[model samples]
Target: MADFRTVPFLPTAFHDDATLDLDGQAALAATVAAAGVDGVNVLGLTTGEVTSLRVEEIGDVVAATRRGAAGLPVGVGLGPPGAGTLALARAAAAAGADLLVAPVPAGSDPLAPLGEVAELGLPLWLHHHPAVTGARRSGDELAALATEIGAAVVVVEEAPPGDLLAVLAGGASAGVGGLAALFLPEEVEAGAVGTVAGCAVPERLVEVVARYRAEDAGAAWDAYLELLPWLRLEVGSPGLRVRKEAWRQRGVLSSGRVREGAPLAAASKLAITRRLRQVGADVSAPYPGS
Candidate 1:
């Protein structure tokens, strides 16, 4: 479980016209994975903007994600077992995905989707997020699902503390999300094996985790603090564009276009330059998005 490091969902990069940038996706993966994340989510309905992509485009994302992750474990998020969902699972499996992140489907049997995709034979990850689905599961329920799917990792987001304890007590390897995960040091101290974070700049996430483990709490807090300005951009809304802009600032992505989400204000993009500079990232290089 200690080996489970911080895993950020790779934000989908796009052309200004909103078409997927396959090369940018790969570059995002390779750069962040190299920065020290143990794993990455390359096919999230939110982070990857899968909701706005064509079914065939998802396969492209799977391939690009695989290329970027190299040999590291790759996680793919699936909603439910439908024709579209199954297609995604097949693509992710073919791409050699090591983990499947799932949420309990609404208006259907909670675990039925996992059972339907059981043939995929991938390790499961329970992403307990109620914000997206408006339904939350107990830790016991999550543990049972993990047992059913033979899951190796569990993620708790927007859930109660006791539920997390329940899952941990069930002998599940638990990862932290929500605000707790925002501060890696606190989450690590509270028994999180890993984190579910955005992949705008993984080196900062890595630094915080490394410092905390090295018993340098001050440095860890300082590192986490420096990232606060950027992270705050996503507080009240989906800041996918903001994150992409940061990647642009880091010289990794070409554009920060979103399919349907809120566009990042130009003022915020300028502020990102200062944020990137605080982390010592060379922001001089310009990307097309910049």
Candidate 2:
């Protein structure tokens, strides 16, 4: 399986008018790569805005990310199930995505689609987030699917530490969301391979993982604590508005514009900025509507 330690779920870049910003997405991808993350996953809930983008647009984003990734492995999330999903998978592969990230389909055996996706020739990372997909499977079932489909990794969310450990023990590479930053130390100790997070602070996430790998548990814990507040603020948020705002403040993105119906409140922006500053982030960059 491909190693995916410290993968940051990137946010799609947009102009002040919320139009797709291909160049901006490339720039963000470059920035994340420069920050030393192990890999980058585009078109996921936070980054690619998968639901809103068409297949061609997703291909554009994948190609843009490929350009900015400095040759790092780029993974693209497979959007909703449909005829387009396979086409998008092919497009992503042609655009240089090294792997596929997708949730197991709701209400049916996931093997068929998963097997077909694996046939695309890129390693598949099965996403197991029940809240979003509204589908739940036992560890054995998930492992069976992974084993059957030859999945390279499984991204899980809202699973207890024991459950997460159990998934890993089942002989499948596992990545966790939710309390990833908080549980990272223990998870890493227990052999969890990676984490899919929207912490907006790639450097810190990279540092924590690096510290743990270096056997510096003390420093890793400190870094995790510093990032805890930001993670708390991000989890359960409606969209990537706060994360995009942080990126804008730090000059990683041109604007924090989100699609319609995912607006970022002014109060929320101010609060995010305050929290970022408290953690010593540089937020002096110019932003839209300034």
Candidate 3:
């Protein structure tokens, strides 16, 4: 595991749905860095839709974000077969990505992709999504990987509470840096280096990270609890569809319509609106103090 103390896990921002048209992507990236967040992650599960974007489009998004970030470290999310991951990593590197994140395919050697990209010498963030990756690596497995690499392997962003806690315990034991949970603010307080749920609300996400850094655990926890309903409403509901819609309502994205499989339903929209109001989220505005 990479040194968690050294690499702070920042929220991974999503691309705009149809509502924002094409400009939402660059805008979101700037919005994140302008807030003083440590870094911005592109091509995330929430944005870029991994398998959906063409290689060129991926590179375009990375470049646009790099320009918008000005100086913030831009991370590129790489997924799938090692070869594909290597290609994306190289492109991100060319586009000035500060870091790279990839999921180690299950059943296959987790070390394979790591080895492929090891030569790049860029900071690496590994994903620990058991559901997507299929197999889970024990703390011992992760520690051994880090030991073998000699390069920093940052935090593991695992999902679900049970898996996240287990990974955290394992990562702590392995001395691999820190662990990241999906969007569970409570677990973040317990010592989840940072989170990767930037799709729902970028400003709020920055606030959560700031609160965590300031050691305002109580306020951080409260902020997370306040938004828990909205967070839950977003999980696996509809690809980029709902996310784009949420961002649109917040005035961050131009619109909320996503690709084919990501259509939003009326009921889901109502649920999202209810949760946002319940949390006192200013859907009519973007960011804090705006």
Candidate 4:
């Protein structure tokens, strides 16, 4: 069995833009890698809407994410399956992706697809976003899938923070989501291998996890509590935009524009700014959303 106790999944950070024109993508990837996050999952619905990125563009993003991650794992998000999924997986392998993060399909057989990926020898990280895919899997389902596929290198991201513990208590591989920042200590205490969150503040996460493991749960939870409002602000309909803007505001990235339908309105920006201040984010200028 693969030990995931120390794994930390990171969301790929990029400029808020319609399409990353190679240069933009590369720059953002480097920024996240330099920020010292553990691993990165790219071309997923979180960075930008997956549907908006062209197949070729997806390859470009993978290449860029690889560059950004440097020696760390650059996990690519494989999709709804069919030709597109296969094509992306092949491209990701060719471009040097370290792992493939994906949602388990409802109708398809995970064993076959996982076997195909295993033939390529790429690690698989399971991502569960019930809201987007409308396909939900329990911890038992995830564990069964992982065990059947011999995928010890696994990642699980579910929404509605409260439910994650139930899944972890049931023994999934890793608990991954923005909620991880808030609930990781409890999940870890309850036997989660590791966690992934979309807060774009890997340093903070690393610190909190270190503190928690050091038996300083109070300090860990305190840090998490301080950052919860920030997480809520950076997520939701325009999470990518808010997150990139926060990164840019902190000098991590250049832009904060996401693709169509991810607009950062004035009210939204103000809300993010207020939340950041409430959480005591240190910066000269207000976050981009503000």
TM-score per prediction, in order, is 0.87, 0.90, 0.78, 0.82
* Alpha carbon lDDT of each predicted model: 0.69, 0.74, 0.58, 0.62
Cα lDDT of candidate 4 equals 0.62
Model 4: clashing residue pairs? 16-257, 16-258, 17-257, 29-68, 269-289
The predicted structure with the larger TM-score, 2 or 4, is 2
Q: CA shift at 173, candidate 1, in angstroms? A: 4.4
RMSD (Cα, Å) of model 4: 3.6
**What is candidate 1's CA lDDT for residue 42?**
67
lDDT of 1 at 119: 63
lDDT of 4 by residue, 1-290 (tens): 02323333433334544446456556656655565566666766455455666767667777876665567777777765445676677887888888777666665465676567667778777666666656577777776787776565345455444454455444535544444355565556555656666565656666666666677778878877777777767656667777766665655556666566545777866776677677666554574545
Instruction: Give the root-mean-square deviation of each candidate in angstroms.
Output: 3.0, 2.8, 5.1, 3.6
Please provide, for model 1 over 1-290, each residue's C-alpha lDDT reduced to its tens digit, 9 standing for 90 to 100.
Answer: 33537788887778888888889989988998899887888656456676677767777787788888877888888753345777777776776777778765554466666676666778777676667766566667767777777666676665344446444642755555543245555455556667777746678778877877677778878888886766666444556676778787777877778888677766777667766666677675543354
User: Which one wins on lDDT?
Assistant: 2
CA deviation > 4 Å runs, candidate 3:
1-22, 159-186, 285-290
lDDT string for model 2 (205-258, tens) is: 787778777777898789888887876676655547777888888887888887
lDDT of 3 by residue, 1-290 (tens): 11122222222234443222335666766666666666767776434566666566667777777776767777787865446788888887888888787665677466777777767988776655555657577655665566665434434545434344445553523222222224455445344444454545555655655666677778867776666666666656463566666666767666565544545666767666666667666677432332
